[model samples]
Target: MTPTDPFPRVFIGFDPREDVAVNVLTDSMQRHASAPVQIAQIRLSQLRSVYTRPHNPLQSTEFSFSRFLVPWLCGYEGWALFIDADMLCLGDLAELWALRDDRYAVQVVKHQHDCESGTKFQGMPQTPYRRKNWSSVMLFNCGRCKALTPQVVNTASGLELHQFQWLEDGEIGELPPQWNVLVGVQDVPEDARILHYTLGGPWFDDCQTMPRSELWTQARQALNHPLALQASS
Candidate 1:
């Protein structure tokens, strides 16, 4: 948590199909966040009017444009964090939250990841693109992201946002890759802060065993455990 605020606002991309996955990620974050956490879902249906540009459905997922709406949703005020719902938090988010730098428009795990190959969850084709996983976990310097207004997010070309063409190189700051450990694409470090099931997770029948799948499986197991529920109550 920041010194001035007791509750941090976090927004996660939401897709109806991934409700359970989102819940696990939320539970993991709340368990570790030091202060009370406020989590909001970014839904495309609600953001449609905000986008003023054409979008290509073939190349998009449920979360494709939602991530870009963080600053707008916050009314371009104080800082806010946006993370994909597929993530599993392993460390206190306050740590990630504290890394915010006001100089840049956004701070992300600057992964030089090649676009993912092979099939994605439920057989979604994995297409490669620049700045591949960079937007998965972000600390939006909302005040600096003024250009990413509702109209821009609604209509900007996918490449402009995903490739980060929206901002100059200096405007982007790098975060430790551990904050977004890509399960299959990269090696998991001893102190990974978050585990991202970029491809798929155990919840899907086809992805019951991706790299670090055990972590997610264990998280779900903990969520389902009666003892865990009793403890929370």
Candidate 2:
């Protein structure tokens, strides 16, 4: 979890409903990463002991609030990346990992997302708030993010956490928007490194037609068809 850490540690939010999404995402990351990466899924069911907060009605995904636990999970030391399950890596993750900055407590793609209020995948309400999708992807400088203890994460209001009230404004660094291109929400960019299916993904019947969904389908196909190994003398 430090600069000396052998591989970049990535913690992905996991929701049981989108199990396939996480699998495909992992496959995409593994295929594109220039070096080995350590990935973990943050499942609420597995953290019953540490995260005991009652579910909030507005919670869209199981990892809504649990995403804040990334720093604490890293033992409040080193650097790590946290991303939503509904994402695909189109470019090498090593490129994204190289952008980590130590000056900020956390780095994210600062988005001014003003999407209309409506329902998203699986009938989830699309609520709007300040710094809406920023938390969806994070590069945590865990050493500087000591403020996010387990108690703070579990007890803090959604706004306080999502808006990053735990740290000063200057401490919140920014990443390029292309790293978290929102499908159907943000304009499709030719160099989008990570495609975020924040609204929904092709895995769901209704979201099958989302922009660049074919890319996700292709990744899934690649996941299912592993390269065959040839026998050697």
Backbone atom clashes (below 3 Å) for every candidate? 5, 0
When summed lDDT is taken over every stretch of 10 residues in candidate 1, the lowest stretch is 51-60
* lDDT for predicted candidate 1 compared with the true structure: 0.82
**What is candidate 1's CA lDDT for residue 172?**
96
- Stretches of candidate 2 exceeding 4 Å from the true structure: 226-233
For candidate 2, write residues 1-233 as lDDT tens digits: 24576577999999998999999999889999999989999998889999988899889899999999998999887889999999999888888888887789999999999877889998998989999999999999898988888898889999999999999999999999988999998788999999999999999988998899999999999877577998998
Deviation (Å) of 71 in candidate 1:
0.3
Worst 10 residues of 2 by lDDT: 1-10
Q: After superposition, how far is residue 203 of candidate 1 from its true place, in Å?
A: 1.7
Model 1 ranges with Cα > 4 A deviation: 1-6, 48-55, 116-118, 225-233
Candidate with maximal lDDT? 2
Q: What does candidate 1 score on TM?
A: 0.89
lDDT of 1 by residue, 1-233 (tens): 34544456799998777788899999999988887788998887777766444546444358877689898888888888899888899988878877877788899988887874656888877878788888888888888888887777777777788878888999999998889999887888989989998888777888887888888878887887564445555
Error of 1 at 24 (Å): 0.2
Candidate 2 lands at a TM-score of 0.94
44: Cα error in model 2, Å:
1.2
